[model samples]
Target: MEGRSQWGTRAGFVLAAIGSAVGLGNIWRFPAVAYENGGGAFFIPYLFALLTAGIPILIMEFTMGHKYRGSAPLTYRRMTKKAEGIGWWAVAVAFVIATYYSVIIAWAISYSYFSINLSWGEDTEGFLFGDYLHLADVPGQMGSLVPGVFFPLIIVWIIVLGVLIRGVKRGIEIANRIMIPTLVIVFLIVVIRAVTLPGALTGLDAFFKPDFTQILSPHVWVAAYGQIFFSLSIAFAIMITYSSYLPKKSDITNNAFITGFSNSGFELLAGIGVFAILGFMATSQGVGIDEVVAGGVGLAFVVFPAIINEFPAFNEFFGLLFFLSLVLAGLTSLISIVETFVAGVAEKFNISRTKSVLFGGGLAAILSIIFATQGGLYFLDAADYFINQFGVAALGLVEVILIAWILRKLGLFKNHANEISDIKLGSWWTISLAVITPIVLGWMMIDLLRLNIMRGFDTETGNYEGYSNMFIMWGGWAVAIGALVIGIVFSLIKWRSNTSAKEETEDISNVNN
Candidate 1:
């Protein structure tokens, strides 16, 4: 195998980790999830989930990657050959995610350009659906592709591919260092401007107002865990793959804490910015905050473009700043997602870096073009909903079960982290992984399954209006579960060679015996 690259500096690794965690989800999803769950009271469960589940799993993955000195698949293979399938499962999850995730970045790029002239104008919703997408009635329909979406999406793939081809130190690390700081500065400017606008106070109050009784609902707790779980980018192969590039002497625990906290802090700031704008929207229309504020694609594509139209001054420039922030956040995270698979392919097949990046990333880019089509939004919605719920959450549950109970490697892993890390892993870490995380994650999985099963995912409006049951099931649920099946197949394939990784496995064996 060729020599592996390490991050140029410790700060580079931390910033890269932060970049991975702080993606489009933190900015668009977290604020709405918090407000809808329990408002002010949601913080209690969210903080609890962060400490118990988020940071603990982060430290575990970092330990595995740093100790085994390999990507996700190689790390799991070295830890115990039987667990190799687990690592490939993670790689598969990342691959599936990258396919749909890339199109989102394309949308941001298009929106950034649209910001220049306020092209979305008064009918932002109509423009997004009718003019921008020309969306189809359902999945599997071959509607004409929109060049507006396709052209910008192609640019996104080109930029990300160029970066991945540059190798880790020169490309991924440097990209994060530049983009993450700029994201912070530009987003802060957006937030400051938003909060001072007329009627901004109304949005903030609605966002932060406590619905104490809502805290009693089981769903609120599940929302907290889900937010932290998905926000940190855990169990998606990115963290482990990124940490594999760290030097042997780096601090593990402190880095996890930093990454986790930075992600949460950014989510809070995003909440502030989003609500302030929502407040202004409501004030301008003489309506309640609830009537104006939203999240997810509506919040980004439709609502925000509308908000910019309402701006008192420099509407185009403020719109440009907002969309640019989205592009930066999405790109930083997208690079890490693509790199996870690049690392896996290179490590598994013993291929060169450039070859791995081309093959793995090329495949994802080809599939991503599907989402740039007129009918693409339907597919993206179905897949995104199921992938995050079943694919990501299930992986988290199984990971803890394997490490803490099946193999009982948590003790040794904890010791490995404490030995190398500045902060010691105490009994609390053990209990979190063994007990708290698994139970919480397990409950989340079961509850989500139950809800989907009972009503079939929002039958009120059919979740997606025109999509058929077969299309939703196969396109969404099947693709998600198929990832696990494909991963197992990859694990069964012959490894080309892994000399240093195997030596580390022997060292772990010596310590165990």
Candidate 2:
């Protein structure tokens, strides 16, 4: 297989990794999670999870990829030839994730257009709940779902495909160079605007003022862990796949920390921006702070538009900046998703870059169209629940198992440890990866499941009232099962190919001798 291009410089690599980390999860999700879980109190567990789950796992992925110098599928095969199944599992998870993940990019793009045209703020109330409430209604509004969902999705996919088709140096690298800096600058501008608003001090106090009492709850700890995992993009197969292109001597530990800190710092800044504006809006409107800080669509669609509307003079400008930031963040992450499956196709089928990208992007685009017409928002929420939550936990398990057990058995880690870092892993690292991480994740899964079960079903809308919670429960399992099935099938194909190649190589060597 042809090797993918390495990042031109260490700075390029750091920016690309940070770009993947700092997406909707950082800006859109993190603040909501932090506020709901107890404001400053959420930082406690978030910091712990960052150190244990985020940092260590990040180091593990980078080290594995750098040491092997191959994509996710091939990296695992090179490390544990006998247990090549693990490698395919990782790729499968990545593929599934990429499929639905593109839909999110589409949402961001659609929202960007809306924001740019000032359509979002104009219909703030109605847009949140009317026919335009979800992308699923797009088809109904147009009297044709295909054009409404499929057509737009295909267009977005083409743009992404065009980027990937350019190859890594020209495409991914170039994108990071432009998007990362722009994203940071836009975020800073938003933060500045938010903090300078009337009653902004109150918002800052709400976010920064630590309430130790909230830390005592198990829910807060779980939120922290989830945030750390989500923010870092760990256990998503993204880091592992991206890291495969790193040069042999790259400093894995330092790079991981750089990416981690850059991502987290951005999230903290975003929280300050969001909460401060939320505070000002609450104070001016005489509404409760909680009402202003509602999560999910409410934050982006409802609350944000409301706030933007309040500043009539700068409404359009701020709206454009906000959506542009979303576009940059979403596109950068979308590139990673496209690369994951494209790399898989390249390794699995030995296809050329153009063909691999076309296949991957085409498939994701088709899937996304279906999602878009079916009310893209619902699909987004569901896919996110399954892929982000369940997919991540599953990925974490496979990673820890592969590194702690399979790689150890092959003596890969022993030889590669010196190449990446001087730090030696003892039983503690193994225990955390194999036992502790999985158990904690499993418990969280159970909690999520219990929450769904207790909520029961609603008959009126033919969906659960707590739809997000339901998605997390059912969606997580669906992703895990889909991933497992794909893993087994791909493993068999790879094993057969590897066996045939070994025999052929032996024949050539023997004939030569």
Candidate 3:
């Protein structure tokens, strides 16, 4: 057996962690979620949730990776052989995410070019759906691949696969060191420009003028927890894999805190920039801010372009900066997502990293093409919703329950983290994972199930976003459930005889069993 890969420096690891945390959701998703939930008041629960669920879980996962020194599946297996499937479950979710997430980044790449001339033209919504996406009239319609999306999709896979093949320190670390800083500088410039616009104060006011009453609602608190959970890239395989590359003596607790806060700080910046721009658009169109506000794809591609078109000057430059920010952010996160499975498969099969990248990443890249077709958005939307709901949220719930309650390993993790961390873990950390997080996440699953099951009665199509039930079944439910099935099945396959990871696990004490 040879030495495992490690980060060149703590800063490199921290930067990589931040890059994974601060993704497209920080830009497109967080602002709208905050606005919809409680305006400025949302931060109360948001910060609380961050402390209770987000950072605590981060510390736990960081400890798992650094202590076990393996990919998610390997880490869990090292924790307890029976628990290995949960790690693969996380990896499978990441694999599903990497497939469509790459396509969204491809859209950002094309939009970055389209920004040069405002090619989306006057009708931004129509341009996104009709011209650019060439969306089908009905759901689940797999029309021909859009040339605009396909070429960029190819480029996205190349860059991501190329990065993964380079290994951790030289590849993933170097990419994050460059991309994360550039993303911040570019986004900061956008934020600065956005706040300086005519109606910028209005947007800022809207964002910060907290309706304290919303804090009283459990739903708002739940939204806060969900945002913190999804935004920080916890409970997925990302944090664990990234931390697995940490050198011995790394500060696990402090690193988790840094990653958690840095991610939230950037989300704050994004919310300001986004709402300011939305305010500008609303003022220009003589409509209320609510009319112009949106999130996700619509906000990134449609509304932003429409707003850019309304800019008094420097439309193309700002558009380029905005979309370019998306590309950088998306790439950093995508790189981490892809690397999760790459590491898992490489270790599981005892293959070279290059071979793993080609085999695993190539497959994800190939499947990503589904989102490049005319029905891509429909499928993308459904898959994203179901995967996030069933895959991520449910997986997070299972992970906490398994680690905290079922296995009762929180104390062991706490001692391990405290030994290596500058900031020692306390009961709060244990209580959060053991009591607070599971309850919140468990409640989240129940609420989601209730809403989804009940939604069928409210719509003619009998499912999410009025997509046909069949489409939801195959495109939505199947993709989400399939990840878990993949996890269990993959765990059943024994590691190859020559696998070094199997030998490495012998050093750790079998406290889990």
- For model 1, residues 1-513, the per-residue Cα lDDT tens digits are 678889999999999999999999999999999989878889989999999999999999999888888888888877777778888888888988898888888888888889999988899999999888898865777577779888888888888889989988999888998999999999999999999999999889988888989989989988999999999999978999899889988899999999999999999999999999999999999998878768899999999999899999999888999999999999999999999889889877888888998999999998888788888888888888878888899999988997788777888888889988889999999999999999999999889868766664557535344357788777787888888998899999998866434565533343333
Residue-level lDDT tens digits of model 2 in 96-185: 666666655565556666665567545676775554434444322212253333554566677778888988778888889999999999
**Whole-model lDDT values for every prediction:** 0.88, 0.70, 0.91
Model 1: residue 469 alpha-carbon error in angstroms: 2.6
* Model 2 lDDT, full chain set: 0.70
Model 1 steric clash pairs? none
lDDT of 1 at 325: 95
Best by lDDT: 3
Which is superior by TM-score, 2 or 3?
3
Backbone atom clashes (below 3 Å) for every candidate: 0, 2, 1
| Candidate 1 residue 98 C-alpha distance from true site, Å | 0.7
Better of 2 and 3 by lDDT: 3
Task: Order the candidates by lDDT, highest first.
Answer: 3, 1, 2
Which 10 consecutive positions of candidate 2 have the poorest summed lDDT? Answer: 503-512
